[model samples]
Target chain A: MEDRVKRIEKALDHFLPERKGSLSETVTDAMRYSLLNGGKRVRAVLTLAFCELCGGDEDMAMPFACAVEMVHAYSLIHDDLPCMDNDDMRRGKPSNHKFYGENYALLAGDGLLTKAFETALSSEAFRNVGMERAAYAAAVLARCAGEHGMVGGQCIDLATENRTVSLDELCEKDTGKTANLIMAACMMGCIAAGANETQINAAKEYALHIGLAFQIRDDILDVTGDAKELGKNIGVDAQNARCTYVSILGVEKAQALVDEHTEKALHALDAFDADSTFLHEFAEKLATRSK
Target chain B: MEDRVKRIEKALDHFLPERKGSLSETVTDAMRYSLLNGGKRVRAVLTLAFCELCGGDEDMAMPFACAVEMVHAYSLIHDDLPCMDNDDMRRGKPSNHKFYGENYALLAGDGLLTKAFETALSSEAFRNVGMERAAYAAAVLARCAGEHGMVGGQCIDLATENRTVSLDELCEKDTGKTANLIMAACMMGCIAAGANETQINAAKEYALHIGLAFQIRDDILDVTGDAKELGKNIGVDAQNARCTYVSILGVEKAQALVDEHTEKALHALDAFDADSTFLHEFAEKLATRSK
Candidate 1:
């Protein structure tokens, strides 16, 4: 797992736009700063692992892995903006807006998002694999990142702030905000590997279950984890009166929910013919993570 | 020309995301409000016109044309943010941030940008034309809109605020902020039509010239045009101490620069075997427009 994570980190560094000593260098600098910040490369690792499980070369999946990470990083930058969550720090470091000011941070987010597509579409691997598959992967990535997916989820989150939301409503928001990208990552990997429709569907199922589990774990941590370990302020959801799994169900119930989802996620991997021991471990670890 | 503009408008309206009765509906609503707002569809028109010039069916290029317009609209929304230009009005209407609030406006911009790629990549026309061409067009569009292109230009623009810059420096900034998208529009049109390398280069040259002319004309309008005529505030460049062609060389010289670039643009159109009367007229009209 550490080896795979290190590989993703290296690929992400390679995929970032190079500084050309131009006036726009600062925005690129900010983009790199936020993207290369030390964070668990969960989505990227899933992409690579799923691709490998589907009998695709890891190199062929590297670009897609990096692309998802770029989208993730860009979302974080925007989420921390003064107009959004206004977070001062992320992952034990200053938030993008705090380090680069609101203006450059905004541009950096925009840059990273745009670069994500560029990286995926321009990759030689796409040509080698198949243009149709590349287009499909790109379409999925864009759709998951756009209005009906991550952005939509964020809109709901902002609107529901300072108010309690029903469990179903929170689930809907989490599916859009969290599960969509994870689903996209898994689907893109299957597509890249030329996996059959059943295999793709199985990957989607796994991703959905794990995505929910991951979010529930986050909620549990927000209530019970230490800020130092989490690399961010804990109890933020409580302070903001934000609707979350723990807020709605208590930490005990949330933990039970995480276990339920993790079990389902592991079961979904049974559809795969290849060894999924790594994924099983990943899901179990996510369910019981301390931070 | 009016017919072409109408076609582009319809295509943009068609391509916009539909609002389901979901919590994210507000962001989609804001995206529609800003995108469908009455404005001259210059970039879209250029895309369709160039496609036709290359002997391609107009319908085949509609998606790409609308995609460029979407990028243009998203840029304006972000540009008007409080952390950026902070303009309260756009095209005689309240800016997106003013109408939707800064947070929604930001998400709307994000949604639009992501949707742009989705529109281009998922179009049936791309499948018909060839996925390779579609991938190439997507790559160009993404690059022209990303950090080294429009975002980079905006970064330079922000960094140079309240200061005078040299004419060369100003041109570099405008090229990224303005010309890059125009170039992408023209190149995309050529790619959609499967034009040869020479034809693509010709379209690029034409776009570069007109792009510079358009920016110069903008500077002239800011100095001499009426706020009501322009549908926004005039003298903004001067007020912000922006380094523009007019600020550096006076209106007369700026007007001359517009004429020079327009002439060169018209000359570049000679490379096309097809009738370029519409594009020729378009260039001349842009050079002398009051708004």
Candidate 2:
């Protein structure tokens, strides 16, 4: 995992736009600052792992994996804006806006988002994936990141802030906000691997279950996880009056839900005859993680 | 031209997402607010006209045209953000941030940017354009809108704010800040029309010339344009302490430059034997128009 994370970091470094010592220097510097800042690189790992498991080479999926990471980085940057999450720190470091001011942070996010597509389309990784399938993957990634995906979910989350919401509503947000991108990562892997419709659907289902579990555990960790391990301030959701799984279901219940999701996610792997060791362990570790 | 503008507007109406009645309503509403606002759909019209002149069907290029417009609109929204341009009005209406607040405006710009790629990818308008060319066009769009293109230009513009800049510096800014996207539209039109390399290059040169002319005219208007005629504030460039062609070259020299670019633009269209009368007329009108 560390090796793969290092590879992703390296690839992102290679693909991300360089600081051109002009106006681009400001935004690109901020983008590189936030993007290269330490994180687990879970989404990129999933993309590469699923692709490899489905008989695709990591080299073929590396750009897609990095693309997803770029999208993820952009979302985190925007989410931490003073107008959004208003977070001052992330991964134990000052957030983009905190370090670079809101203007640079904002353009940094924009630059990263646009750069993700550039990476996906023109990267050497897609050279093996073929243009048609690459286009398919690009469409999928954009849809997942667009108004109907992360942006849509973000709007709903913002609108529902400070309001008592039903579990279904929160779950809907989870599906749109968290699960969609994860599902896109899994689906992109399958697409790159030339997996058929059945395999793609299976991967999508697995991603949904695991994505929800991941979000629930995130809510739980915000309340119970150590700051050193979590690398962020605890109880932020509660402080913001945000709706979350741990707020709706107590820590114990949320943990149970995470377990249920883990079981379902593992079960969705039945369609695959590969070793599945990494994914099985990944699901379990993510579900019950302290961070 | 009015007929084409109406067609472009209709295409945008079809392609711009409808409210999904969820959290999507908030951001989508904001996107719709800024996108559908009245303006001369010049970029979209140019896309359609160039495509048609290259012997492509209008309906086939409609989505691509609308996609460019969406990209243009998103740039405006972000450029108007208080953290960016700090504008209160656009097209005679309150800016996106003023109407929807900064957060929504931010997300709305984001949503529209992502949607531009999505529209380029999945719109039925690409049915006949082939996935390869469509993917190629998508890559072109993303590249033109990225650090080397719109965002990079914007960063440089922002960095130079309240700073004295030379005519060469100002022109370089204009090329990146404005010419790249226009160049993209013309090149995309050629790609859609299946034009060869020579024709594509010619189209690009034409776009670059006209784009410079168009930008110089915009600078002239910023000084001399009436608030009602321009449908926005006047003398904003001088007020912001920013350098512009009008400021660097003076109004008379700027107008001459516009005329110079206009002549070169028309001459570049010599590569096309097709009826380019509309384009020639369009260039002259755009260069000399009051608003």
Candidate 3:
């Protein structure tokens, strides 16, 4: 797992825009700052793992993996803005807006988001995977990250702040806010590997379950986990009065739901003929994570 | 010109995401509100005109044309944020942040930027133009709109606000912030039409000169034009103590520069085999417009 993570990190560094000593160098520096900040890299790892599972070259999947990570990084930057979640810390360090001030941080987020598409579209991987598939993969990333996916989810989350919502509502919010990008990552990997509909659907299904489980686990950790271990302030959701699975269903029920979703995620892997031991362990680890 | 503007307007409306009565409806509405707001569809028109000049079907260029317009709209929304320009009016109406509030305005900007790529990558024109060309066109748009392009230009503008800079520095800033997108529009049109390198370079050169001319004209207008004619406040550069061509070179010299750039822009069109009467007139009109 550490080896895979190191590989993903190296690829992300390689794909980042260079820091030229030009007028716009500050924003580019901010983009690199937030993007290269240490995170789990789960989405990127899933992309590469799923591509290899579908008999595709991991090298071809690298671009998409880095692209997904970029989108995630941008979202984090925006979410931490003063008008959004107003977070001052992320990953045990100052949030982007805190580090670079609001203006450059905002531009940095915009830069990363635009850079994600630029990287994916210009990648040499398209020559190997075919442009049609490459275009489709990029479109999927856009849709998942755009109004109907992550951004939409963020809107809903903001609207529902300070209100206790039902389990179904929480699930709907989590699906958009969290699951959509995970699903995009998995589907893009499958598409890169030339997987047919059945395999693609299976990967998507797997992602949906694990994504939900991951969110629920996050909520649980916010309540019970240590802030140092989590690399961010805990109890933020409760302080903000934000709705979450743990908030709606209680910790025990949330834990049960995570286990259930983990099982479902593993079950979806049955369609793949290749050994998916890594994915199986990955799902369980995410469901039971401390942070 | 009016007929082309109407066509561009309809295409923009058609390409905008539908507003479903979902939790995310407000951001989508914000997107449409800002995007469909009455404004000169200059970039879109440039795209389609160049496509037609390159002997391609205008229908095939519609997607790229609309994509450029989307990027322009998103930039406006972000530029109006309280942290940025902090303007309350745009095109004679309240700015997006004033209309939809700051949070939705930010997400709307993000949604529009993402959707721009989605629209271009998923267009039926890709099938007609070949995936390779389509990908290249999308990459071009991304590059122009990303950190080294529009966003980078914005960063420079923000950093240098309230401070006077050299004419060369100002030119570099405007080229990135204003001319990069215009160049992308012309280049994408040429690419969509499968134009040769010579044709593509010519269109780029034309766009670069006109883009500079357009910015210089804008500075002149801000100083001498009426508010009603401009649809927004005039003398904003003076109000914010921002440095522009007019501030650096005086109005008479700035106007001279605009005329010079306009003539250079027209000269670049000499490379085209097809008649470029519209572009010739477009450059002249832009150089002399009151608003």
- Residues A200-229, candidate 2: write the lDDT tens digits: 889889999999999989898888889887
* Candidate that scores best on DockQ: 1
lDDT minimum window of 10 residues, candidate 1 chain A: A122-131
Model 3, which residues run further than 4 Å from truth? Answer: none
Worst lDDT window (10 residues) for model 2 chain B?
B15-24
- Candidate 3 CAPRI category: high
TM-score of each: 0.98, 0.97, 0.97
Tens-digit lDDT string for candidate 1 (A130-243): 777777788889988998899999999987886778988898888888988998888888888988889888988999999999999998898899999999999888888787
Candidate 1 has an lDDT of: 0.89
Instruction: List the DockQ of the predictions in order.
Output: 0.85, 0.81, 0.81
**Which segments of candidate 2 are over 4 A away from where they belong?**
A20-23, A123-126, B123-126
TM-score, B chain alone, candidates in order: 0.97, 0.97, 0.98
Name the better of 1 and 3 by DockQ.
1
lDDT, residue B159, candidate 1: 79
Candidate 1 Cα misplacement greater than 4 A, ranges: none
**Residue-level lDDT tens digits of model 3 in B172-218:** 89999999999999999999999999999999899999999999999
lDDT of 2 at B210: 92
Error of 1 at A106 (Å): 0.4
Report candidate 1's interface RMSD in Å.
0.9
